[model samples]
Target chain A: MLAKRIIPCLDVDKGRVVKGKKFQDIQDIADPVELALRYNHEGADELVFYDITASHEERKTFLDIVEKVAATINIPFTVGGGIRSVEDIYQALQSGADKVSINSAAITNPTLIETAASKFGSQCIVLSIDAKEINTGKWNVFQNGGRIDTGLDAIEWALEGERLGAGELVINSIDVDGVKKGYNLQLTKTIANAVYIPIVASGGAGIMEDFYQVLHSDIADAALAASVFHYNTISIPALKNYLVEKSVPVRSVPSCQLY
Target chain B: MIAIVDYGAGNIKSLQIALTTLSIESTLTRDETVIRDSNAIILPGVGAFQDAMHQLRSDNLDKILQEQAAAGKPILGICLGMQLFYETSNEGGLSTGLGLIKGKIERINANVKVPHMGWNTLQIRRNKHITTNIPDQTYVYFVHSYYATDIDNDDLIATSQHGENIPALVQHNNIIGMQFHPEKSGDVGMQLIKNFWEMVS
Candidate 1:
């Protein structure tokens, strides 16, 4: 049985970990590697480091942070943000990352996904969609940290991503980003059902039950969170124990700190 | 020193990190001289069968690997690298393999998840070099859409329970192939690597 994954996303900027209310007014958390080791100890299936930067210098720092986190965590970790070319994906993978995620780069140059997939295989490439509900309930894809709208339909983009060899799809609900109401079930299902690749549900995980509800459905193979984990609201071991109680099949937690 | 063949397929850092943690001295290389002189070889890949074959052929490293295996130099194939060891693969389209083992690669049934992306326990069928001390039902990480099939030989040392019996480990003397990434599979995975290193040493 495939284990259900619990991932905590850390937004990296200038080598510091930050989480924002809907990705705005960011608040500094701990160092990226520090928080990563904590979760890795707590039995986190994986970690995602989103490099949210607006400057080239800061982006370089994000790579440094990624290298540090990759060194710190024993589990699989993914890095995304400001990646625009095949060389960027290669550098990230070579820097010790197991996966390299892309958003705006894929939307701007769909060929980048093809090139990266061809070079590094689809398993290393992840397509993250920042989806926001527009008027009348149609979902729109957002870029530049959810500030600029690409006007591309979320479902259509996901389908194309799969066609272009995206190994996984990360459906992040913009409306539910930090709202913690719950996952956007409908949107997640739409993309998960459309693409044959694995789908990871991102955004809107407030409690253990939220994870239960979202995973019970066929929407996502994994769920990602940041604040809940950073604040230590729900420790990973306890959460996995709860899921085990609920009969949610998961990987056996490492009995001790692997490091 | 061990040599990890880098033909531009997947991440080699995890394996390098694992090797370093174990105090195992190894080099990530594609140069034929370095690989041929190494004590053992670790061939890792992550990609479509055709693309991997293309890369291996283009780099002319395929011949060196075959020669090493022929010389009875222990070679380990991790995940996609293992798939390439088979005779043929039907992933995406039918493609030729390295013919190191008598098997074929096929896609996991669509009814089950397209990519078997997580941990599952190993069920040892026949105890061998890789499964010498690995307890039955010990879980290891896996991530792939295709699986090795059409193997009628008893070289299938272990199996992992899925919707069906998926081949977990298959070994033939010095040449061993692992369907899972032991390097990324934590301690158990490291144990497998350490055991291999001991064999070649």
Candidate 2:
């Protein structure tokens, strides 16, 4: 059986890890590479680098950082944000990223999904959707960092992504993002039941119990958290141990061993 | 020196980085002479079987790899490269593979997810030198939709349970195949690579 993945997302802006209200406050928590190394040693199943910076020069630095991180860590790494074309995807993969996540760009050009998946096997393309609940039992898809509402139904959009050849779907809940309440289980389960591809539930992971709830509920293949992990509020090794106690089948390093 | 046979696979950079971290010198090349003269050859790939085979044949790497294998050179195939060692694959059509091992590649049909991505424990089938250092049931990363099936049981060395018993490791004399990416599988994977390195040395 494949173990449930625990991912630490690094939201990078202007070559720095940023968070807080409106994502304006640039927190000097730690260097992205150093934080990545810590997660690698601490047993993070994967690392996600979301380049919030849109400038071409910053993108180059992001790819350079990607090369450094890939050279240092021995786990799967995913690069996303500002990836609009197949060329960007190729650049990221060539820079040592194991997978590339497509968001707003995927909506502007649905053909990008097919082009990328066909060019580089579906295993390398991840379709990340930012969804916000508008009415009872309804959610709308958002793009451009959740600033534009596309009016596409979340479930329908997920199916479309699968049809377009996305290997996996990262359904991020804009309603619950940065709130640290819990994952939007209803939205995640709806999409998971709709698509056969693996679904990674992102946003609103406050405690280990939040991870246990979503993973144990069978609504998500993986749980992604940023602030909790970045701010040192939760430790990955400890969280894995907690999940093990709950019988959640998460990979863990031995007590005294980490390489 | 180890020559990582490059056929435009996605993992070339990370694979080379993994070897460097282990202090093992290696080169990514398509030159027939380099691959033919290396201490060991690694066929690394990540793509559709037909496309990868097409690339290999177009570049004449298929002939070179077969020649090296015939000469008793240790050859290790990773992921899609592993699938290429079989007789045929059912991906994107019934494409033929390099007939180095007697097997057929088929889609994983055990009612589980198609890709079977993430970490899983290895079920060691044979007590081989390549399985040394790494303890039984240690978790390793995997990412693929198709798997090797109908292989000679004698060639099978290890299996990992994902929807079904997917072949994790196989060895037939000088040829070896690993379904998972040892480069991205962290410490346990590094140990497996080190074991393969020892075999060639």
Candidate 3:
């Protein structure tokens, strides 16, 4: 059976990881390539690069970062944020990313998902949804970095994205994003149960038990975290060790040496 | 020089980079002359089986591959490229493959998730050049919806469980196939690539 994946998401801006406050504020933690290499050595199953840059030139810089990271590490990584078109997807993959993730662009132009999937295979396209609860339990899709609610039901959009040829789904809850409490089990389970593809539970991952709950709950094939992993509050190897003790299958190199 | 087939399929970059990391010289070529002239060939792909076969056939690269394999040239196919070596595949319809190895690609049983996307431990069945020095149960990354089954036990090198015993690695004389992406599968993957490169070098 496939081992559950533990992903460390790096929110990058101008080739450096943006740290501090759930991906807010300008704080450079380390070079993206260096950070990715560290994670690779520490036994991270995969990595995700979220490009938070603004201009066209920055996209080039981000692609360069993706190339450097991809070359340095052997594990697969996904590049997300600001990917608007098929050309963007092409450039990202050409620069060495295993998969390109699209968020707001998929909402604005759903055909982007179809065209990308058809052109590059569905495995290369990942539909990333930023969901926030508007009513008691119903979640609405958010755009432009979780500011604009698109009024589309989260679950409905996920199914549509799958129909349009999305191979995997990444559900990130905006309400508990950086709270460091736990994953939104209700929101994640609802989407995971509905979709056949692998679902990555992002946001609100704090303790090792948090990952345990989501990964074993059949809600997430992978659990993604930024702050906990980025700041070393939870080392990937230690977390994997804990999961191993808890009987959760994780990809861990028993004798791995980390810097 | 090793000819890394450029069939307009995916994952050519990472394979090229993996070779570069090993200090091995390689050329990404679609030209038959280049492929015929090279000492070794690496067929890297990631996508639907039917579309990949169509691209190979349209460019006549399929015939070139057959000739090279027949001429005793060492060949290594990764991911979908490996699936294309079988007799046939059920993906996107019943598409024919290179038929170099005796097997058929079928959708992984519904017992597990589709695209079985993640890392899994390799269960080494035979000690071969590819599995040399690679520890038993060492995890390797995999991402695919279909797998090659009904393979002869003699050609099978290793198997990984994903609701079933998936053909992780296989070899028959000069031709080889790896179901997982060795290029993206960390240190163990790099070692396997180096071992393959050494076999021909």
Best by DockQ: 2
Write one digit per residue (lDDT tens) for candidate 2, span A76-156: 999998899999999999999999999988888999999999999889999999999999879999976578899999999
lDDT of residue A244 for candidate 1 = 85
Write the residue-wise lDDT of candidate 3 on A1-259 in tens digits: 5799999999998878987664466788888888999998899998999988646878888888888887788889999988999989999999999998999888989999999998998888999999999988799999866789999999999999999999899999999888889999999999998888899999899899999999985889999999898889999989998999999998867464211
In model 1, what is the error at residue B165, expressed in angstroms? 3.1
Tens digit of lDDT per residue, candidate 1, span B1-201? 889998886677788888887888899888988998899998888877888888889989878888888999999998999999889999878989888888999988757766677677888888766665577777777878888888856779888766667888888777888888887676677778877887886
Q: Candidate 3, residues B34-117: lDDT per residue as tens digits?
A: 999899999989888888899999999999999888988999999998999999999988979999899999998867778788
Residue-level lDDT of model 1, residues A26-45, one tens digit each, is 89989888888888767788
Candidate 2 clashing pairs, residues 3+ apart or interchain: none
lDDT of each: 0.83, 0.90, 0.89
Q: How close is candidate 2 to the true structure, as a TM-score?
A: 0.98
Return whichever of 1 and 3 wins on TM-score: 3
Instruction: Give model 3's DockQ, 2 decimals.
Output: 0.61
Ranking by DockQ: 2, 3, 1
lDDT of 2: 0.90
Q: Which ten-residue region of model 1 chain B has the weakest summed lDDT?
A: B128-137
Q: Model 1's chain B TM-score? A: 0.96
Which pairs clash inside model 3?
Answer: none
Residue B115 deviation, candidate 1, in Å? 3.2
